[model samples]
Target: MGKLQQFLTGLAACFGAILMGSLNVWPSYTLELYTDNTTTLLTAPMSEFESSLVGSLPSLGAMLGTGITGVIIDFFGRKRGAMLLILPIILCWIIIEFSSSSIPILIARFMGGVGGGANLVYAPIYISEMAEPSIRGSLASGTVSLYCLGALLSYLSGWFLSYGMIIWVNLSLCIAALVLLSIVVESPMFLLRQKNEQEALKALAHYRTGSTGSKSVLEELSLMKQQLLPPVELVSVNADAEANEEATEKEKLNTDEVVVVVPPKSSSLKLLLCACGGCVRTGANRRAAFTSNASCRAFLVVGTALTLQVMMGMIAVQVYAGTLFKQAAPDLSAHFCSALFALVLLAGGTVTGIVADKAGRRVLVISSSALVALCMGALGFLMQSGVAPAWVSAVVILVYCFCFNFGAGSVPYVLLAEVFTSEVQGIASMILVEWVWLLNFVLIAVFPFMKSLMGVHGAFYVFACVAVANTILSYINIPETKGLSNKQIQEVLHPKVDKQNSIDASLSVCQKAVFQEP
Candidate 1:
């Protein structure tokens, strides 16, 4: 494929990723409006049994669905896993649109949550695998950018259309997802792991050449196949060792095959510790040398960045913006406030994508976090003092939004994924994402209560503190990750002691297995 075609393909993959991630945000955007209206119309307090039941049921269902779908993602290919999710999401929207009672709407929302959970897992995997390594950060971060776009669009739709129209709009999104899937190929990594050489070749060819067939493509396919092939000698050695161990154990038994076996007793704590210490002395001592290194520091920074970004971007801004505006201008419409917030968020994400590669990840992270902190502090002061105008509040919030996306919003995943080796990349990514979701859940659930108790000014003071802490952490710990390959990042993160021990341990194991094999 030509450079243009490859870029377009990458763009499509990014767009798809964004669309999939958007499913996760729809519930958040609409829940407040839906719950408040339902409470008033039912002639009950928001926390009354019936009102709370109707309002909270969907989120409960979504949480349950998210748990189950997270496990299912490992078995199904990312694309197929995501595709499976669309059905339930579409069904949920349909039910929400047509149902009269709270029960049906709750059920639909729960079902949609299942799909959203699956989408969260699959979208990043698909985009990262399909994109060229040179632009992988941009492509991966595009998922976030697009996700914000989806959330913005959802808010816009809700602001302009009736509740019924919003359901139809969500359904249309699911249908559009299905159509897009038909054109996109499965992840090459998934294909390789499945041992589908021909399919993997086809994917690599399409990814590299864009055209179906050519001499150059064939050569590249051959090289990919060779590169992906397993080591037959290693397999042979493992099998031989297993067979020899079985024979040796059999030989130790009586010829009559009447050997009595005594059950091994469990060791006491003292004995277990002694045995463990002995094992450590016999070369397992290397693990102690693996204490917090550059990589570990990077992980910490990345995780913090992720936590703060989601907190500031969606939870803080979406939940509190209208209230803050209302404090300044009592007549400001919720719809108008929400739309403006969404536009600022979209702008932040869009600008981040354009300059991230050039400005570098670490610099953007520190600078952006600092800027957000400053804006947040200003907003808080404005809210505390009665002298600030509504427009000042909005302008400060926009600055906060822009600075956030440019730094914290964009760099977390890129840093986490790039800092680890391929062997541990999946685990690292999972840890970062798990934290993201956990923090998001906490921020969303407690935000209203926090705002009520602290007021808008105090709430923003908390956010500013978080932003400042995040900035300091990034500056001290996270290294520049731009223009560096994954291996290089890993090397920078792992200290000499850890690196040497790892090498020695791996070599020792390989040598023992090789020399002792039958």
Candidate 2:
């Protein structure tokens, strides 16, 4: 896309990231109200389980939301899919504004989670669809970088604002995101899939060149069609008409002949079961298999990269920052420490966005993970040995924030979109996003118990080990995809195709496998 249009698209995506930040750190500030001896809710402070649920239920809601977002976007279009998220967020804030009891607060947080989940799934997909190859990685990562900024805002507001005032500010943000997203053009990919090629061309021109009447619009449209379309079976005319079909008859297309696989409106659990079942199902797995070893490796690289992103414990830190800081330094204020952590994270994400297309994905992920591991190990040692001062945990957390954001935080979001071809992108993203949420829930839910078992120090020691393993895996597997076209990346992944041959061979393999009846 042209610079101005690209900027607008990135801006819209970044707005969603900001909303995600609010959802992310929602608990960090709000939970304090219930847990503090200064306050009373439902007659008493939240018990451990209630506290855990209050913080973790949003993840449960997010997991559910992301599971169905793909089908919603597929059927309703990305713009509408994003707009649908706004109501829940607004409702969430409204409920929070009026809530006097714990139950209403819990429900409000769940609603916020629902909105956050959609933002996470849709932002990368929207940015990837709208961006050109030269700037794709940079733009896709920008959403997450903005997410860090949003988190910073969340922490700052949580620290300073009363609950009612914070809800109003968040409500305003939700409305703002809704207005911005409503005006953006529909995704060109969705238009083409619906067989509205003329409109798709207009969108491409508007999105890419900032004009629907540009002279080169058709050329760009043709390139898009070439990359996405393949020869396919069409409805047959009567044999008598068929004789004329090859010679003089106009081509009759049947848009209805296309398969529409809108998955049932199910929660994340059903989706996970369905994904696993599809893995062993005969035709489905074969069709979606990689085109060649390189492609297979590329797929593995990205899938593992996202998983490693979760396991790195960065997100867990976001969710449980208050708890960790409280344990690490009793003398320091948890609220202030968490805010500082988020600020460092925001800086890291900014640096990652500037450097993503230049420094490349592999080196950053490895380097970031390595530094995180070292810091985690050091923090664990200090806490365990009792030789550490109270300030040590704060310093280590700041360092970890920088390390995590520099690579593990932002790059995975970019690659999540960049990894798959257009054909398999939707399913791949749905599954991967679900995986991320599931892993996030497990880590956060078990974290306090882990602390009980091993103390906070031992808990971080385990995280340090996971970080070390992730560093090794990223170093060995990730391919650099800085500035290459999707088509070129496809070729790199599925090298079995003749270098001269286009997407046909790869599409043929995936189409049959991707579309088989379940």
Candidate 3:
């Protein structure tokens, strides 16, 4: 029952993910419709430049949406903020359904991008908060799996349904998603942060499928409080010490026993740095988490993973699936082949979600990334030689999709939500996701130019190289985070200094002191 309730909430989040996935591939199938001269749906056939705008504009809008996620999620609360975020998607479809020209549809796509970008952060955060640690990886990755489901559905819909019908279908799904989100309770952690203890307990109980007074529910709530709140006694002690120290400093100044000197340039620089770090938090816990060396290292890992994830060419393939298929297999139906690609994504993501807890994040990512590199390298050879059978190229592409999703598609997101404490999760996620959207915009916008300049084989070669590098990095850097609590993960990231290193440092200090005294 506890798992059921959590699944239901995750299912709500999945609905939004589905919309994002569909939007991602919408241009893949619809670009032809707008660009075809015989089509009556547009004022005129879209120019090459206009078509690229249609395909890439959402990513730019996503950047804007991701940048503002901390503000929206923090201000509105996760549940309500997600519900409010759905409004833009709904509005996006409405504009598309009514508009006859490219400009309004472009505007609508940007709005949809905003909703999609926010979901990239919101769904992972919401699911991670509501799920038990045992099942967190599955629920989190399930969202990505479902995003593939959305893309698969969109491919089929675009193949079979009319443009107007596709618009209405998405609109209906948006309404259904909003309804599901309403049924779920607010995130228990969000409530705890807001200091609504009673409500937090109730929310936790709802998710746990137990009464607030139950031992399991109470214990879990207590654990969340411990993780999120600073120790009150420690805070008070620090406050009193600071007060006494300030008084002593004032006395010294009055007696002329000490002189204070401030450098304006250094003071201004220090203030700027502090203000930059402080933007994420005002509380002690959040400030420490945001400014910690451990968090910075984790961010570096996530950032590099995210860069590799984008550079590996999945976004380009997803956005241009039909075109790629048409090029590779002129005899096969491109639409069917594109749907096949999405199906592979769905299968790989679902399998990853099911086994992530058992196999662990590091192993899955390292092994699958190696396979991705192999398949991509094979595809490049097939494309460059022009001698391989059409089926060989198609098979290699499908295999690449499956291998990419097996780990790369979903694991980094799990890491993003897992590595940070709740204090800095919102801001950290925003910054990382914003980076992703910016990459999406640049890659998607330039992919056509790249294909024209370097040829498809060249692009595949570039992606293969990136996948190889990613595999190496994941093997060396990614920690095994399976079944560990957030605190345990943090300890792994920021372990205690070795006793031998500590002793050697002490001896070195003593030696320095002796030499200086002489």
Instruction: Tell me the tens digit of each residue's lDDT in model 1 across 1-518.
Output: 53344455444444533443444455545556545755432233233354444434444544554455434545676566656766777787777677656667667766766565444444555655555556666755665677677777776776677766776777777777777665677766668768886787677676775543777656655644543342221111222324465564343332332222221222222222322244323454332222224435555666667776776644667556666667655676766666666677778777767776678888888898889889888988987895767778877876787778767877775665456433233445555565666676678778878879998788888888888888887888777767665546656765455555555543444334444533
Candidate 3 per-residue lDDT over residues 1-518, each given as its tens digit = 88898888888876788988898789988998899999788988888888888877778878888877678888899888998888888999999888888899989999998888788888888887888777788887877898899989999999999888998889988999899989889999999989999999999998886898999899989899987744221010111223454563343324422222221222212222333444213322222222333565567788889889999999877665566677778888877887888899999999888999899999888888888889888888888897877677777878888999989878998788688767667777888899888887789779899889998888888888999999999988888888888778777876354556434333333322222322
Task: Go through the candidates in order and give each one's C-alpha lDDT.
Answer: 0.60, 0.71, 0.78
Q: Pick the candidate with the highest lDDT.
A: 3
Q: Which regions in candidate 3 have their CA more than 4 angstroms from the true location?
A: 231-292, 319-324, 445-455, 498-518
Question: How are the candidates ranked when ordered by lDDT, highest leading?
Answer: 3, 2, 1
- The residue-by-residue lDDT of candidate 2 on 1-518, one tens digit each, is 46677767777766877887877777766776788766744456776777777877778888878887788888888888888876777888787677666778788778878877877777778877777776777788777777777778887888788877887888888888888887788878778878899889878887776566676777766767765654333232222223343341222222233432222233333323333454312324433222223334555677788777777777656555666577777777766777677788878888887888888888888899999999889988887887867567767888888998889878888887686655556666777788888887777778879889988788888889988988998877676888887777766665343443334333334333333323
The model with the greater TM-score, 1 or 2, is 2
What's the residue-level lDDT of 444 in candidate 2? 74
Query: All predictions: root-mean-square deviation over Cα?
Result: 8.5, 7.5, 7.5
Off by over 4 Å in 2: 35-49, 210-216, 231-299, 315-333, 452-455, 495-518
Task: Name the lDDT value of residue 372 in candidate 1.
Answer: 84
Best candidate, TM-score-wise? 3
